[model samples]
Target: MIPTNRQITPETPLDSLTLDELDQLLSEKLVTLQVDLLKTYEQQLREHEETLDHLHRHRRAISLPPRPTIGQDDWHSYVYDTRPSREIASVTDLVTINFTNVHTVVDIFPVALDNIHAIYKLDSGNGYILQDDTMHLLTVRNQWTKSPTGCSCPGQASDTRCACCALGSVLCQVSASGVSNTCVEDSQINSHTCSSQSPRSLELDNAIAFEYHTYSEGVQQVVVIAKGENIHFYRLDKWGLQDFHSLKGHNTINLDSPVTHLGYGEMFVEQFGTVTRKRYLFTFGLDSSSKRYYEIVTNPQDFSIETGLSMMWDTTGTSMKVWQNGGRVIIGVQDGTNLNIHELTSDRWGRQQISLQQVLSLPAGVTSWRSYATGFENFLIATTLPLPALYLTVATIDRFLQTQRNIPRNKLQLVGVTAMFIASKYEEMYCPEIGDFAYITDKAYSKAEIRKMEVTMLNELGFNVSYPLPFHFLRRNSKAGSVDASQHTLAKYLMELCLPEYSMCHYKSSIIAASALCLSLKLLDGNNWSDTLTYYSRYTEEQLLPVMCKMASVVVKSSSAKQQAVRQKYKASKLMKISEIPQLKSKLINTLAEKSASYA
Candidate 1:
């Protein structure tokens, strides 16, 4: 919170300020605060989007090389083909994890998937409080996973008292020790008891745990029980479960309270116009609805919730979490087969309005999933707990390898990881420790090796990483083509298809991108390459035809090619499943390739 020139001069007398002057001063400060808020908000938003885009492209070496296809069925007939140079890893994805009968896997706040403490469902309402692979008799929650249990809690809760542990009629009160543990913990299961108020039957759709900092009561743990439109708030202190008045606003200096967090209320008393202010905090979250129902609670005091000003919004969402106290909202919305995730910030001006800041898309189901928030901050610690950390890794490796005429095979793995380390520093939002990067190699390289290599690589490359990438040019050319979502994605797939081919490296990136898009438009039965594309791309149809031929040739061999990473990636529904489109196989492409090749 930097002091601004707008601050009323401390040297000025208080009597000189009038009510109108005070109001004017307050408005200006607020406007300035909001502008600063918006700038910071936009910056974080851009980093998040770039991180996703960075991950979306190549995902670095995070994904295991396509299942190793060289062994097993083809081992007997497989003959090693000698080439000038080849990959350190097999391109074909051979390793796969197979499961049967399970419809949905629910794990809570997992550190990792394979080794997580969770309660999973094996369809038909049969629940397993412990993960099948983890194999533990104990569970964090006391839900009878075996036969028909007394509770048919459909949803899993974050920590100890999950909705799954709740019998359609009772709220489970967990001990404060389980407070920090969201999904499961290795600790003993806490005793569960229903609220003493009788009939004790209330079905729960979702249960969330959050921390609240009160004006008087330092830091308190809070739990929210959301079922349909009805919400219940409970406080979890050392004294155990106590009812909180409806859900008053939580105090946070983070993204939650935008203005005051920046001290907008502290107008100068002497030099600045004097302003007395009463605090009015607001909170908004999904109230409940298949059609996306939400509610905004306005003017709640620090201690108690005010009932009169709750406003509901007509929208759809599956789940939501308030982060930075109440500054921003993270929501999960179901869009067809995919679950769309979004981040929102409250509108600085409006009492009930919130702005959408970020978006994410995930596949229908995953064996293991990790929920992220607070920890996604722009800290220096690498969580590989996984960005430009994608292309930066590529640029580093390409530069290092291209410069070194001869490098040892054993050191190649070290070089690869070292490049990733350098890239993460340059491009990644949150970079892990140098030791953490070393661990990713299964101890093949020591921390000292990675740290030493990092220095060597940076010095050898002269710290230059501004290598132009195909994705960059592809974006401009796609805009020039004025293509639709499918056409643009198909173009991306075509461009990526040529990435593995050694020969394609000879052409300029801009030409390669232009050619891929040009072929995509023609293949889709869309318009021909126009003057705009030629002008922006600086590649005429005849010149592009040659590169376009190479791209088409890569596509023809893509399905059968050893490098299946590009094909497997674009085949997902998220990327519009462009690789599976039929135009890649058409004779028209063969004709174009032959025609282009004939020129040389």
Candidate 2:
């Protein structure tokens, strides 16, 4: 069987071999190839069998309870409106009368006066009373009218036509002819609905501007009203308005400006070997061009305002929120077109000092106001929708990778999927089982592996998974702008496109929604941004242009082969086939590019 080849050495060429030797060499190579191919096939089959086994085990492990029906609990009752039957027309008519001529409601408060449940409606300059159960509007005195035509004095039969009249007044009658008492039933007032009922007006002596703040601890409720240079506090009981307290500003403290914002916070004090709850009030004032912050302790019998940190800051305070039970204060300040966060430390003493935490620059095409609102709106929506939860999960994973640069690229999808699992559990009523998630991935990961990865992700994220998504803001902004359904869907499509781009996280949810809405409107050739939209969205065309361009770029990119989830989702007929709108996509990209370059 061994060929000698005429005493051939190792230097003998294969081409110089005899015909029988060549046939033997080819046959041996063919046998080796067949063996290798069989082994590869066997390995792949084993892997497939393992995947199937894992899926079967996962299915066996999952056990979901039966879905509860409506009226099972408070949440179900709210969603299903499981209250006692009432006249729908009467309720609608009552609401119309109560809200008439009220340009903005601002705030509403409910209190039990004696045995009657009453609600207070605070309008810009006027106040109205409502019987909570019967939905009846109660009349009060000193109500003025400020119509677009002119202002009318009390008891005036004809239009006064005074330009200097105060804007605050009671809710106007629904009838356009004139003011009348027919809005409220005469019998209800004559019968004295409640024994302790009394007329209450929010008006303060010489008050040019006012704001309302409320806080509750256990059964005790307190309402604080800031008017001009004074802050008035009221304690409420089951019978309403128990005690009234006022804190007057002195020349030294100089609270001469209107109170722009009011907030209440609670802190835990650990001193003398015991922990106690301490409540505090935070007030922000704008004195002409200067902005000031005041902290006042509202506990310990003797209340005092801490003016140590009253010095003015250069930037104007646009919005402020207290989180972590008042331990952390997030202040949004305007620096040109950008909004920056000023985080302040808190202690038993008061607010220590302000430190600049983050500066959120208004990304080219959006205003600071809209951007700030978007972040909050996204948070609200994430609490309800699974899609938004998934978006947030993926975004968080991307954020972690940017910070931890050593993470392997292959594990990104695993981390993202685990995040989605966590978000779904936190946000959804019925979270998808682990087996279901595995199925979605075509069994790429087993249930056991995914469960392990969930623990890892939770640890990495510090168990914090709740965050806002752009969908919430888009829905809210679109509704407020009265945008059509088709246009709204298009805007949502645009927003989803931006979700995969990690860089888009720098912009706020409001800005993203506004930019998307603007682009959608342009593409649909619908009504342009109106004054109503501008007032509600707080964004101008100039501000949205840059953001729109960036969104357009994202849309174009999402249509490519690499990013297909969002594009495919929108390709369905139910979604209006937005992803397939080639003409609109092309137009948006080109227009945005030209506009963006011109602005630059």
Q: Quick one: best lDDT, which candidate? A: 2
Q: After superposition, which runs of candidate 1 have C-alpha atoms over 4 Å from their true positions?
A: 1-389, 593-600
Give lDDT for model 2. 0.49
TM-score of 1: 0.38
Task: Give lDDT: candidate 2, residue 398.
Answer: 64
lDDT of 2 by residue, 545-571 (tens): 788888766665564646455665566
What are the per-residue Cα lDDT tens digits for candidate 1 across 80-120? 11111112223343254434534433222111122233323
Candidates' lDDT values, in order? 0.47, 0.49
Clashes of 2: 9
Candidate 2 regions exceeding 4 Å error are 1-385, 557-559, 582-588, 594-600
